[model samples]
Target: MNLLEAEKFPFQQTRFTRTSDIQTIIKLFSQFSKEELMKKNQEVSIAGRMTGKRMFFADLTDQSETIQLKFSSENKKFAELDNGDIIGVVRGIVCRTDTQEKKNERKLSVEVEEFSLLSKCLRPIPSSYYGLSDTEERFRNRPLDFIVNKQKKEIFFLRHQVIKNIRQFLEEKKFIEIETPILVSEASGAQAKPFITHHNKLHRDFYLRIATEIPLKKLLVGGFEKIYEIGRIFRNEGIDARHNPEFTTIEVYQAYENAEYMMNLTEELFHYLAEKVFEKEKFTFNSHNISLQKPFRRLSMIEAIKEHINIDFAKINGLEEACQLAQKFNLKLEKFQKTVGHVILAFFEKFVEKNLIQPTFIYDYPVEVSPLAKSKPENEEIADRFELYIGGLEFANGYSELNDPTEQKKRFEEQSKQKELGNEEIASFDKEFLEALEYGMPPAGGLGIGIDRLIMLLTGQNSIKEVIAFPQLKNKEKNFE
Candidate 1:
């Protein structure tokens, strides 16, 4: 019978006492000379999977580095060992490979006095020398990918460091981290389609939050300032190298702050990560060598369009003129995009967005595109909004929030009209949010950053899958290839 099919495997051990891990052993004794190691002759107990050809010599690896294992001679028990067998404990004296030492090699080995099998790997695990090359297969079977690719494991470590540092930085500034409901009655924060599900007990449908902006702002009205949330967001959207249906985002709100203050804070937070967390000044992202050391460029959207192309948006005074310009450029406008503000956005996206290769702040958006943002006092046509772009990708968005209940109601009404006019991604008319606005919220700044995209930029990864451990992929036939 197969070993796993037996009532109990005769070779398996229940437990063992491990004195240290392979990483600790490598770090502590790698610098010692062969003679120095022999002088100490320290005894240790370690457990790991057997990884090489098992005969008189083999390798043992844990979560960290691998170590060599040596026996006096080939025996019946040693010959039965195969790669991927989990050893319970190899209790032995730590010493150098005194007889088979190689030039410039310092990895110590365990002179095994005794060991037992903890478990047997019934499935075959590929060699660590060559990891899984098929991208789809690697993503589908993440455990195997992690087993063979050391760098793949390192990416998650870097991701953890990024989140940990962010929390530490905000905590130092007295910013409180809060969590909002994932299943919301209505999704109104962002302009995206939401995933819907029925709540059996409530007998009503709920939406997986597309953005955490709404509930977090509600907390601001309930007498909390300088709050933020780092949580998962779901969207019923298309997938690409940059997008996943399920992802992470962080939304921050600060009462008594304006758009300019939030912009400065965004820049400082990035600089802190580069200097304090990673300690690196330069990064290569989207084939561009971008640096975090320099100050970011700031330009208005209309100005960017002007800089990229010779078209002067300031000259287009009316909707008729904007329509004529759109016809000249062959720009197609949707049913809801019939206004001058929409035309301005169409022109900016077509001519300006892809040219922003470095870190830039594009500010002063039109009111039609920014409903939650406050309109400028001097010019009601423009909203006090800004977005951060690096490598032609949007990383952060921030604006001075609209605190007027009456104006907010008007905006939602406009959104309702648009929803009827073929805009499927319009924010719902959230009456509760409007009521919260009536309760008198302070003038504040709200900012949101996509955590996965930010990780991709910082890690120099082009595809979103490299940063995310398990991303959504197309369903394979029957089983994953």
Candidate 2:
């Protein structure tokens, strides 16, 4: 059984003051500036962890603010106090004072007047210097990690700002923010394996959605011109620093717009977010600073590959020849590789992906990899798809949707063949979605942004775990069980 099921219990009410209501405490402390209290008078009372505790005095850092507590057994009020006790009360003015050992220590000292313990700590929290080194434990008990590490908290805060700014940008552009189902019968949005569970009442199995693309597209087919959904998607895959079993993605679609328009829109959105949310007009990654200003660099897929790898993918007409070339360049390729586009992708990823530290749009992917996108007019082998990369990370993928019912069916059939041929990530065809497209989905553009990856980039966090609040972790063995 999963941890979620094992921990299932009847929902109960909470009694303590919720975390947010501490604003009253903030207001009370606002009477004295943190600096003024340190200089003129040294007094304050607050509820916080004893981050740094000592014999005579200790620093209490709370969610609202930080203040120190000076204790004496004769003082009666603090006779029963300890470092980790969650206390509440009134104290003298908060002051900054130095100790005999360290002269430069800045502290908010409080002379305890009244006190009460809201909660008591039995087990000591691990020391921050050697705290929660194991990755699984850290993710499982994430709230404690946030309490111990300040940088982790800041990264998530920046993530919220990124999402907020994106919402504002889309709303400003008249894009309606909508929601889609997480459980579905057909997961035709993207190429990924899904987690499936039995629907007891329905007597059927439903898979978790891998992407919001299909449902959002259904809305577009239903006559809504512009819409977007920022939601959770689940994929059954191996975990790594860059991948999680469950993550967030934002999908947007606009009626009558091509992939080119979406490319421009994505760049504008990212630039606006960097300037507004991050408060930094330029991004520095891997020693290269990329300015998120208007008119970002854009290049055709073939052109980018050619510039970096010195290879002409246009001339590599067959998969067999492409595989030979990849082998010469030490790229990952199987002898049974069937698509020239797949070979181009493998070659670019091996040789050129790391060089794209700045914001760059690589356009015109192989049609084999983009089942729902329109094919290029001049070269039917290529699809009108583009992916935006920043700091060597693929942030967004968009394409001009294949609206013609016949072409859409043919692509789905190809995808079905791939699925049958042991390609576990190939999408399972959704007949209803295809039927909706048959009703004539207008020529439109669709985009899916990896929200977690975007947040990681904006927050300057190299690992996806840093940006996610409670990333999925392996089930821990419970001794009680």
Which regions of candidate 2 are displaced past 4 Å?
1-46, 76-79, 90-92, 95-106, 128-136, 284-294, 330-336, 474-481
Please write out the lDDT profile of model 1 over residues 338-404, one tens digit for every residue: 8999999999888788889889999999999999999989999999999999999999999999999
* lDDT value, residue 77 of candidate 1: 59
Clashes in candidate 2: how many?
Answer: 8
Question: If candidate 1 were superposed on the true structure by all CA atoms, what would the RMSD be?
Answer: 2.7
- Angstrom error at residue 246, model 1: 0.6
TM-score of each: 0.94, 0.86
Residue-level lDDT tens digits of model 2 in 1-481:
1222322211221233322323354454546655766566533445556655566576566654455566655754344445455555444444444567677665435655555555555556666556667766777788778666766777767787789888999999999988989998987788888999999999999999999998888898899999999999999997777889999999999998999999988988887887888778776654567777777788888899999878888777687788788779877654324678888888778777788887889998989888899998898899999999888878899999888888888988988887777788888878898889888788899998999988777666667877788886655664322
- Overall lDDT per candidate, in order of appearance: 0.87, 0.76
**lDDT score at residue 213, model 1, on the 0-100 scale:** 92
State model 2's lDDT: 0.76
